[model samples]
Target: MDIKSPLPFETSDKAHANLFNRMVNTLVENDNVLSQQIEGITNETLFILKGDQAIQDGSVSGEEYPIGITFMDIGQANDTGYPTRYGFVKNEKISNFRFVQYYYGTGNEAGNYFDSTGIWCRHWWTGSGWTDWHKLSGFLHTNIGTTGKQLLTKAEYQKVLFNRKIKDSHNNFDIKNNRFICPENGMYSVNAGVYIESFQRYANFELSIYLNGIRYKNIAHHRQRPESPSDTGILNTGLYGAANVPANKGDYLEIYIYANYEGDVSRYVSDKSGWFNYFDIMEIGGRNFPRV
Candidate 1:
């Protein structure tokens, strides 16, 4: 039989000759029957239109499948995306589709068991196309104490309470050269009488008064006093003095004494000296009040 080869008969046409040569080269290179079968299968199965259709039609509407929706295993390896669990739904894009894991529990109660002790569980978000995993919740719990009795926040306790002595001074009424001024509008009775000025009450305090740089007396509210002088001379006489004046809303009284040498003391002796003498007067103390 005189067989004819499938070569280009028109040698004058270069394009047709080139096409024929390419066809012959491809056939010679893949001469196996398996290669021919594979080529046929690829041509029948591979369809770009199907791929485009799948991409356009495949969409995950979160309303239909809420969080924690489990997905069954599809036959294809690529289709098996993620395990179904309860958690946040993220990255609802076409390139990535997945299900994240989540859980909730209380912290270590009395017995290290997860109970209702105001502690929360840990959670995470993961998927196929996502590069990194994320933490949606932590294991630590917060203390929600009772209202009004709870600890004060930084913004609530940012203040200072101030208590200051606005004015403090002492008047010496008996100093020979030194004169004394009355803090109140009261009669200055110079005799064996009491002179009292109100002051703030102090608890557990040390009070001291000086006469010409000499330590006159030191006394507290709860201490006993020494015996009075019998001389009646009144000079350097130890007098029973007190500074304890009770005050509810913080008030105080101060007191001093002077002898009227011109009065009834004239019946005593030769020097009827009822004139005022030099006496340096002052008072100082502190009160340990309760803290608010």
Candidate 2:
């Protein structure tokens, strides 16, 4: 991964202009293996060659710029110059012969700053032309605080709030809202578990996973209590639930619990403690196929 950094360019310099144009053309023509960089004034408009424009792959002006991978950042490039705003192009031809684009500035429902948001897409080059772009989803894992969360009312379901994030690969998890917004169209693996503090008899608990405010699956529904009132040594158990949920982009998921006892519930907060209270989601598979 050789980096060509601080490669200065002047707008009025004809030699620099010609070199920049050639570099752009080189990026357009190359498939994968090399990357070139150009540092210049921000927000400069650059053209990308598409559909067999016959540009030389490693020829930049009179010099030969070898190509394996290409990377350039011309901040906020005009929409007229490229299909994706503020996105740089990278070509990678592995065994699949696919071109991949990893980009940010994707506005999300979780109110993530556009530049902080990111996603990846890829398409195949089928000899004739490129295929449609396929967007990939992100993964998320979050959990509650160490002190545990309390259910205020018995027999009434309430949204469980997770205040900590163990993993948020795509910035899709909203900790403040206790929801995971789907970043792309796909099926997700949803899993969550909670341990309620039990100090009474015949206490019941039910946990459900919700998709876009609708109950999608019940992960836990059971009763737990002490075996005997005189039994002083007893610890109740936690409930774990998982489901395969389908969601479109911008769709969100949440977890809710209904308990017959109104009290605090312990959650898995520390790996060393071996407690198991947490929520997790990951994109399994799905694609928006382009019509022939």
Candidate 3:
């Protein structure tokens, strides 16, 4: 009678193969059907979840979503939610033994990937849940504050890491200690710049990024010598230095600056223009946190 329209296959024996392939294709077309596809999948098995979900044709009307695990946008598109979180999980239980969250950065304000918001990632070797997670975060701050007018003594060195005012995302940078605590073990970019002025000619100044209380040698630092104009305009020098270095959790960095002047002294001028004596620190997200 009706032999199921002859089922597209070489022979009746290949009908099962055709059925299996069609089933997989269907599973790859609609994420809504993911549950049915993985009904017999094992824990260690990995599968692609593809498809055009909102549309239907028993075929991918848009994006082809494979089956097994799904990278659903539970939150707003592009993770622009009041705050976006990223981590891998299978159904709620931990997958790849991780679950990281950020408490800071609102709606794409961005905290350079991982931020201070009590950021914690699951640690399978230790345990699970909220109590058993690892702290991984990024920090940002500047060297601007209250105390002003510090004329460097000849050949005097100092940690010019802070002014009288401050803004710390996670308390990672200690104004009191003049140190930036490494929030996580990863590659970081340390940068420093100062708005300086030399009343007399031939003023030599140095600004640097120090890691773990030691001088960072990766970035070669040259002395800054502000030129004395023959006219009434005072000479102002913008000193900048940066370095890319690896740091372990709890390791720290500092901004050290010095001046060796034979005639007049060098000074940390005012931040009237918003670009005076500042420092920047950022974790290399592309290197530290690879896409999961």
Name the candidate that leads on TM-score: 2
- In every candidate, how many clashes are there? 21, 8, 14
> How many residue pairs in model 2 have overlapping backbones?
8
**lDDT for each residue of candidate 3 in 142-232, tens digit (9 for 90 to 100):** 3434355555567766776464445555457776876778755567777666676655455567776777778774333345344652323
lDDT of 1 by residue, 1-292 (tens): 2223355445888999888888876665556554566657643243222322222111332223333322221122242222111111222222124433222222334544322122111122233222212222221111110111111122121111101111112222322322233322122221111111211221121223322233333432222222442224342222233332211112212222222222122211111111211122222111223338
Which residue pairs come into collision in candidate 2?
32-68, 33-68, 33-69, 34-68, 34-69, 35-69, 105-114, 268-277
| Residue 45 shift from truth in candidate 1, angstroms | 12
Q: What is the lDDT of candidate 1?
A: 0.26
Q: What TM-score, computed on C-alpha atoms, does each candidate reach?
A: 0.14, 0.51, 0.49
Q: What is the lDDT of residue 1 in candidate 2?
A: 37
lDDT of each: 0.26, 0.56, 0.50
Runs off by more than 4 Å, candidate 2: 1-133, 136-147, 225-235, 261-274, 286-292
Q: What range of 10 consecutive residues in model 2 has the weakest lDDT sum?
A: 57-66
Write one digit per residue (lDDT tens) for candidate 2, span 140-227: 3334332354543666787876656776765678878889887666678888887665554566778899999989899988776555
For candidate 1, the per-residue lDDT at 106 reads 29
Candidate 1: regions farther than 4 A off: 1-9, 13-21, 24-132, 135-146, 151-292
Judge candidate 2 against the unseen true structure and give its global Cα lDDT, from 0 to 1: 0.56
